[model samples]
Target: MNFFEQQDRARRNSGRLLILMVLAVLSLITLTSLALGVVWQLFGQSHSSLWLASDGAIGLLPSWRLVGVVSLAVIAVVLLGSVYKSLQLSRGGQAVAERLGGRLINLAPQSLEEQRLLNVVEEMALASGTPVPPVYVLDDAGINAFAAGLTPQDAVIGITRGAISLLSREELQGVIAHEFSHIFHGDMRLNTRLVAVLHGILLLGLIGGFLLRGSSRASSRSSRNNSAAAIIAVGGTLWLLGYAGTFFGSLIKAAVSRQREFLADASAVQFTRNPQGIAGALQKIGGNLYGSQLRAGHAAEFSHMYFAAGISRALDGMLATHPPLDERIRRVTPEWDGRYPHVASLSLVPADASADQRAVAQGWDQALAAGFSPASATAAIASIGEPSAAHLQQAHQLLDELHPALRQAAHHGSGAQALLYGLLLAPVAGLREQQMQLLQPLLNADLMSHLQALEQPLRQLPGNQRLTLLDLAMPALKQLGTEQAATLCAVMARLIRADGKVELLEWTLLRIVERNLAPSRRLSGHFHLLELADEVQVLLSFLARAGSILPEQAQAALAQAAVELPYTGLNLLPAAQCDLKALEAALKRLNQLQPLQKPRLLKAMARCIEHDGRIEVAEAELLRAVADLLDCPLPPLLNTTSAAQVG
Candidate 1:
């Protein structure tokens, strides 16, 4: 499936999960109620004879009121538990990684392994046109990794120490590609939701355990043996029922997770275009003693999120989160010959030593001269979730072209803060002075000094490079304290306003940073394309005007876009009505468009910008900004002279 299909499928899977979870809960309630009724008949029916005497049908059944209350209680507990866990995880991917004993990998690498991992992740991000997500290291001797987060902005990649130390560079890339598949296919959000919902179902088991423990302690002290027996019976019953619920809940989780793993494995091969890389990793896992088993205690909770299962299982093997190891390897590498490679510890070899420096430099030079074409635009959009070898080459060359100082600045939190400030600084003398004056009071002297030092380098940066730097700095910027982040947002807005007009690049930078760093303020609404026509028109007009230098040009661009619309008579909104504020509001609503609707909207946008038969730097930046708002990562539109860009 393509990117849009994957998104739509993930949404449908979420609905399927809900239906299954409800059924599990209902089953638990029924079993628990029946158990309660049996207990009542055995103990509470004092006046009637013991063995089904005068009590008749009434004795065998639970009270309707009791059943109602129990059902309500079960529903409330499950919903509340799910919501609480979801909220906790909503703090972002970092929370989930840390909860599972992952240590954040510093951007400034202290070790060769760290540097190699960062480079791989950066290349993948650039290739796929995504912000570079933070990487975390789990201190475990296991070959596994996972992606986590509610959205791309907060997404994080996690790897175990064993995977880094044991796997070859190619093998590691394959594994990272697998996790990226999860990020690109919208699996991370669903994986997190599964974690939350399972927590809710498991809460019943936890409560039962607590009740049994409390009753056992009370029984030890009580002289009223009969009352003590009753408590123990009730506790045991609840415990049994809770465990029974968890059994089926896990089945549901296993069923949903298993199929996705196979698809991700296939996508990994497709993404890297190297089946042997992934197939080799699996073979090593089969041969190695650890075989992807994590040492972290919480590994079991996120088993499905991993590149491979993080914990060992026995009977649960039937409900495993990943397919059997041999089966996976065979699928990826059909000529496996039924033999696993001898796993051995890896030497500390430099990962990219074999990379061709000359070829990489040439790639960048060629990409610079290549202008955007309609075909290139389409390929760039389609390549959202699927990065190819060319994209990888471009990403590599792009990294090489970036100034070392600017690149290094993107790795650290303090430096990243200064980098952001540098991007927002105005070129005009008056506006620059105004912005500096406003910033001096709000920020400390050290940060201001850093920003001033980086100003020249940042100014020399190209439009595309500036965006890549912003993408690189996202993880570090997200590390800022809440107050600091809020201050940064306010200061950025102030600086933008200080210029007396909103430049497209300035506004794009602000939107990208805030969307990634600040808490998500996604406008929630149902997808209704017809209802959103005016908002769509406003946005298209903004794009049309932003791309053209003259009123007639803008009108011409608008006309091109109108051809793609389902209805006629859509005209360009007035320039006054297409300001940044209006554009922002329009985007918030447009963002709620259905996954299928997004392609049409994006196609219209492409028509609007390419109407003059060229895409300028400013127009490309605006396109990237809109894509970012829609949670889509558009690759840099290479300057191609003609179409046939896709291989």
Candidate 2:
């Protein structure tokens, strides 16, 4: 999915989450409110003569007041408990993202091929106009990969050592591309959200346990045994109810995430146009003794998000997020004998083999890739439309067919320019001498001192923190303006090229860095090739109208965009037609907006299209189509009624 679709998904999800949160809050409120309602009834009833047993009996007002005070205390306690639970869940999720991102992995870019994997990942980030995510090598025997992060800026792609050693470069490319697709789409955010929601759900059980233990202790020490017994019983009941919530929450968490894995697999195949890479990787997983299981302490908590099965032994279909390995393999390769491929057992190889040996290995792989007929491979794998099979084949073909030099070139030059920029800016080592010079002049002595203090810590930082550091530095870089920014990019490119015979990975990295700094440059390549409309009115009105559409309006808007941007093949209609629940949410957000503001919002979007003097026909058409669905009127592209008025 594109940025717009991802944003719409996020907006819808956020709205649903907010509603869930409100309901949870109300549920807590209702519990206390019910308790208060009981107190109020008791207070009102105490005024009647029937409440008093005798003249010596305690006055009813005192008992009513005592009851009211207890109700207030209950409300306060419950509210505080709810707030604490929310905060704890949020904290746990952030901690996970930060810790995962900040993790260090000792991966040597030993071979040109391994370096290329880094370059391609970096290149894709540039191509997509996002930062290069941190890369880590898992030194395990398993052949698996996974991407993790709360945001694109803070994401990480990790692969096992076995994967690197066993798979050909083409196969690795397909695997990495699959992981990158997860980064580009809305998967990261949803994954993080799942972590938080699951934590909250689980905490209910913890809370119940805590309260029950405390009440049990208090009851043992109390003089009034019956009253103490009553308190313990209530606490025990609440605890049991909370456990039920936890049970359902865990099921929901696993269910929601499982299907997305299949979609992610498809997206990977789409990005790389190769199936063999992923298929080979999966085949390797099935053949390996260690398999794809992770030994990390937090394995089960993150099971749903891992690239392969984390807990191999605990494989229940109901709880397992990943489908069975045989099923996955069969889906990718229908002609498969259920038996595993005959991969020789791995031996301890020298980390730095002779240059001649490396070249021979590389040559052997290249010859194999060249010799294999695409048609033969296609026959070996299932057709593309067969769930995962066709897509996996395409990815493999794309990876295998590309010349190593061209693969490297794709990492550098125009194809990978933006992603390179994002990566270059991501780390201190990537900063060009001139870019640093420009930056140094802008900061005051105190800030420079602060920078000096930070330098050591920054240098020691891991992938995610290093990216975060880049984000922190962005506002300062933005201060450099267009001309200076362009100059900085040129300097970065030269630095990357300084070693002579620039590698494709290096070029891709530079490109990604440039794009992150200048998002407006995203469609610039297309703009150069296409003729555009001279008037801004058409584009502006179209976007304005499209922005006002209901959730259900996405399909119509997408259909319109598809017609406008003919070649892009943006599956807008499918993307726009969200589930029914999403429609209600869109209506809610629309309802909250002031009528005047909605039009203004549309106009602002229109203005974005009209920033350049001319708008391409595709751009204008897409904007207007979206605007039309938003229930807004389209003004004339040009006034034809009166030339005098136009003048």
What would the TM-scores of all predictions be? 0.93, 0.49
Per-residue error (Å), model 1, residue 292: 0.5
lDDT of each: 0.79, 0.46
Q: What is the lDDT for 182 in model 1? A: 90
Q: Give me the candidate number with maximum TM-score.
A: 1
Q: Which ranges of candidate 2 are over 4 A from the true structure? A: 1-102, 105-117, 126-129, 137-144, 160-168, 213-235, 312-315, 341-647
| Residues 185-249 of candidate 2: C-alpha lDDT, one tens digit per residue | 55665666665555554454466577678778887787576645555554554455455544545
Displacement of residue 608 (Cα, Å) in model 2 is 13
- Candidate 1 lDDT, 161-280, residue by residue in tens: 778777777888899888888998889988888889888877877877787798788888886766666667767887787777777777777888888889888888877888988898
Q: Against the true structure, candidate 1 has what lDDT? A: 0.79
RMSD of each: 3.1, 15.8
